[model samples]
Target chain A: MALPLNYSFRNALVRWRSTIATVLGIALVVFVFVLLQSLAAGIEKSSSNTGDPRNIMVVRKGSTAESASLISRQTLTEIRYFEEIARNENGEPIISADVLVLASLPRRDNSGEANVLLRGVTARGMELRPQVKLAAGRWFEAGKREIVVSAKLAKRFANFGIGQSFKTGSATFTVVGWLDGGGSAFDSECWLDADECRSTFERDMYSSFLIRPTDEAAGEKLITRIEADRRFKLKAEKEVEYYRKQTMTAAPIKWLGGFLAVMMSVGAVFAAMNTMYAAVGARTREIGTLRVLGFRRRAVVAALLLEGGLLALVGGVLGCAIAFYWNGYTTATMGMETFSEIVFEFRVTPKLVLEGLAFAVIVGLIGTLFPAIRAARLPVISALKSI
Target chain B: MSANIVTIRNLSKIYQQGDINVTALDNISLDIASGEFLALMGPSGSGKSTLLHIIAGIDRPTNGECRVQDIDVAKLNESQLADWRNQNVGFVFQTFNLIPVLTAYENVELPLLLTRMNRAERRKQVEIALEIVGLADRAKHLPKQLSGGQEQRVAIARALVTDPALVVADEPTGNLDSHSAQEVLGVLRTLSRDAGKTVIMVTHDPKAAAFGSRQIHLEKGELSK
Candidate 1:
C-alpha cells in the first residue's frame, strides 16, 4: 500500500532537532554556491559591458590585451587619416592614441601593495568614451604631471583622491579629478595625457588606438584595411568584441568556484546521510509495525525519501534568500587580464538562484538514496524485535 | 460448526544464529475454523509466535506448507505475500503500535489505503471502525493523547477497519492494565462471536486465553494437542 505523504512530514516535524541540523548544513552549501556563481557573473558583466560597438580597437597582431600591444608614433599617424574613420565636429578623425601601464599602489584598508592600471589618453579620449563622466573636480591639463582617477579606484586606493599626489617610479602625478565609468571596465584605470606618460615611462610607442568608424560598412572595411597593410602587422576588432574576449580572464574563477562547491557538497551530503541514518535507526520498530500492517517496503522507502526532499527544499529557498538580499553590494578583486583591481557589484540573478535550488535537490536525492534502500531491506522479524 | 479457514501441514521454521541453527517451530500441524477465537499459549522460546507469523503469511516455513482461505501462504513470493496479508490478515501488537504522529482516525484508515477505495469511502469505513471500538469521538486524538484502554481500542479499530478474513494478535494486552486488557479482550470476543471474523491470539496468560473459544499450547518448538 502507498503510504500517505503527511506521515513523512509529521515524522520530520516530530524530530525537529535532527531535521534542523541537516537543513542548515544544506543551506550553507547552497549559500556558497549562489555567491560563487554571482561572482563569476559579475566579472563577466564587467568586461562585456566595457566598450561601444561603434568603435574599432587596434592592437598589435598576436597581442592578447591592450597592455601588451605597442603602436609607434609613425604607425598611429598613418592610421589616423583613413577614409572609413568617423570625423568629429571639428572635422578631425575621432581617435584616441592611448598608453597603458601598471603601477603598484598601497590600499587604504590594508598596507599590502596591489597593481593599478595607469592609462594615458589623447585629446579626443573623453569624447570617444561617453560612458566615463567627470564626477568631481576637473580634467587634467595637457603636458602636466596630472591624472584623473576613476571614482571606484579613488575609493579603493590611497593618495588617489582629487588633489592628492602619488609617486610612481621617477614621476609624481597629481589626481586632479575622479571620473565614473558606470560599472564598465574603465572604472579600474587612472587616466592622464599620452605624451607625458610616454616621456615619463621612457617609451617611444603607444599601447593601442581606439577609433570610431563612420558606419557598419566602414567598420568592416576598416578592419580589412588595417590587417592588409604590410607596413604594420596589426589586428582590428570591434571594441565590444575585444572586451567580450577579456571574459576569458574569469575562467580560473569559475573553475575555482566549481571546485569549492564540489568539495563542500561532500560534507553536506554526509551530514544529510547521517541524519537519515539516525532516523531510520530510531524508527525501526515503526517500520516493522507498518510492515505487519501490510505496508510494502517500497512505501516505507518512498516515505523516507519524501522527508529528505522536503527538508532540502526548505533549505534551498533559505539559501537563495541569503544570496539575493545582498545583491548590488560592491566589492573589488584583481583582474586576470589587466593585472589590476576591478570593482564590481554582486549580481544574484534569478537564473542563478534557480540553479542553487536545483543543486540542493540533487544533494537531497544523493543523501537519501542509500538510507532509503537500507530501510527497505531491513528484515521484518529483526525490525520488529528492535525496541 | 464453522468451516476450516486455516489449514497447516507439518510447518517448521529454522533460524541460523551464527553457525548454530535454532529451530523456532518443529513439525506443527493445525486447523482453525472460521469465526473461531483460538489462543496459542506458550512460554518464551516455545514457537507459538513463529506459528502465528507463518499463518499470517509473514514468515516462511523451513519445511511443510500453510494455506489460509485456499491461498498457499508458504508458496507466495515476498510482494505477493504482502498483498495477500493486506487483503486477508490484520495484525494487533502488544504495544498497541499506533503511529504516534497519526490521529486515531488516520491510523484506522491506514490499512484501507492499500485498496482502491476513494477518500469518501475510506472516511466512511474509518468512522464505522472507530464507532465499533466506541472511540468515534476520539478519532482526531493522537495515540499519545489517548489513555491505555483508548489506545488498545484504537488498535482494535485499525485491525477491523479492513474487514480481513483473520486477525493475528501477539500479546495484545501484555502492556495494558487489567481493566484495559479486559476491554481489548471484549472487543476481540465481539469480533469473533458477532462479526464471524476468525481470530488467532498468542499470549502466556491463561486468564487472557479464557476469552477465546479454544486454546492450543506449544512447548519446546512442538505443539501439545
Candidate 2:
C-alpha cells in the first residue's frame, strides 16, 4: 500500500532551511532562463509583426536587406507601368521607389553612439504603409529637410524629439513628428522625403521598390515577371515574407539562453540532490519504521520524488512571475539584417511559463531518483539499529 | 493448549563480516504458542535481537525453517514477505522509533494504512489501541512532546493497532526509565494475556523478562541449560 502524501509534505516543512535554499537556487536559474528566452521572443515578435502581405518588395538579387540593395531610377520607371500594378484615385501607379541609409546618433543616456535606420519614401510610400501612424506633430513636407522619427526611437536617441535637429555629413535634419509602428520593425526607423534624402546623401539610385498589386493573382504574376527579366537583376517577394526572414537576429539569443540554462541546471540539480540525500540520512530510522509498517520500496521512492517535484514547482512559479515583470517592457538590440538598433519589448507568453514549470519539474525528478533508491534499498534491520 | 503461532526448527543465521563468517544464531529451535508472552534474554552479542528479527520476517535464517501462522517466512520473496509481515506481525523497537513529524494518533494509524480498512475503521482501531495503552488523551502529541514512557506507550499502541496475531519487540523498554519501562511491559503483557496475541520480546533486564509468561536465555548464539 502507498504511504500518505502528507508524510512527504510534512517532512519537507520540518526541514524548511534546506528546502528554501534549494528552491531559491533553482529559482535563480529558472529566472535567468526565462528572461533570456523572453528577450529573444520579443525580437522575434518585432520582426514577424512587420510588413503587409499584399505589398511586394523588390531588391537587388543578391542583397540581404534593403540597405544593401541599389536599383537605378530607370528600373523603377520600367516596373511602374506594369498592368498588374494597382492605381491610385488620381490614376497614378501605387508604387514607391525608396532609399535606406544609416545615421549614427547619440543615445539619450549618453552610452555612446549607435546606428539608426533612416528611410526616405515618397508620399505614395506613406499611403502604402498605413500601419505607421503619426503619434504627435505633423508629417514632413517634400524638400523641407524635415523628418518624422518613430516614437520608440525618439525616446531612445538624443535630438529625435519633435522640433529637434541632428547633423550628419554636413546636412542638418529637423524632426517634425513622432510616428508609432505598433511594435513592428518600422519602430526602429525614421522617415523623410525621398528626393531630399537622395540629395543629402548624393545617391542617384533607389535602394528598393515597394509595390502594391491589384490582386493576389496579379501579385504572383508581378513576382514572376520580375524574376523572368534577367536585365533587371532584381528579386520580388511579399513584404511580410521578407521581414520574416530577418528574424534570424533572434537565433543567437535563443541558443545562448538554452546554453546558459543547461549550464545552470547542472548546479541546480546537484543542490537538489544534496538536500534530498541529507534528508534520507536524517530519516534512516524513520525509513526503517515505514518498511516495518509494510510500505513497499517503490512507495518510498515515489514519496521522495513527489517531495522534490513539489519543491521545484514552487521555484518554477516564482521564476515565471519574476519574468512576467519584464513583459511589454521596451528594450533595444542590434539587428543583424540592418546593422541598426531595433527597439522591442519583452514578450512573456503563457506557453513559456508552462515550459519553465515543466523544465523545473524534470530537473527535480531526476535529482531525486538516485537518492530515493538509496533510501529504499537501505537494510531495514541495520537502519532500525542506527541512531 | 492453543495452536502454535510461531515454529522454528534448527534455524541458523550467519553474517559475513568482511572475509570471516559470524554466526548470529546457531542451530536454535523453539515454538511459541498462541496468546503466550515469551521473552528472550541475553547479554550484548548474544543474538537475541537477531532471533527476534528472523521471527518477525525482517531477516531470513541461513538454514532451516521459520513458520509464522503456518507460512514459511524464510522461503517467501521480499515482496511476499513484506505483505506477510503487514498482515500477520507488528513490531515495536527499543527507541520507540516514532516518526518525529507524525502525532501519536497518526503514528498509531500507520500500520493500519497498509490494510484495506477505511478511514473510520482505521480510526476506530487506532483509538482502541491508544485506550488500551492508556495514551488516548495524548493522541495529538508529537513524539518530542511526549515523555519517554508516553512515547513507548504510543509505540505499543501502534504495534497493537493492526491487531496482528504476532507482535515482536526488540528491546522495547531499553530506553525507558523504571516507571516507563513498567508501564510499557504491562501493556505488552495485557496484549498477550487479555487480547490473545503471541508476543516475543528480546530484552537483557530480568525485571522486563519477569513480566512475560515464559522466559528463555541465550549466550553466544546458544540457548542456556
Error of 1 at B176 (Å): 0.6
What TM-score does candidate 1 reach? 0.95
Residue pairs clashing in model 1 are none
**Residue B25 error, candidate 1, Å:** 1.6
- Candidate 2 Cα misplacement greater than 4 A, ranges: none
Range of the 10 consecutive residues with the lowest summed lDDT in candidate 2 chain A? A378-387
Q: Which has the greatest lDDT?
A: 2
> For each candidate, what TM-score against the reference?
0.95, 0.97
- Predicted structure with the largest DockQ when compared to the true one: 2
Q: What is candidate 2's CA lDDT for residue A381?
A: 83
Per-residue alpha-carbon lDDT of candidate 2 for residues A1-387, written as tens digits (9 for 90 to 100): 677888888888999999999888888878888888999899999988998899999999999999999999999989999999999999999999999999889999999999999999999898888999999999999877899999999889999989999997458999999999988999999999999888898889999999999999999999999989999999999999998888777999989999998999999999999999999889988898888878889988999999999889888888889989999999899998899999999989887888888888887887888899999999888777777
Candidate 1: tens digits of C-alpha lDDT, residues A89-189: 99999989999988899998886989988888888877888898898989999878999998988888999888899998579999999988888898888
- Model 1 lDDT, residue A200, Cα: 82
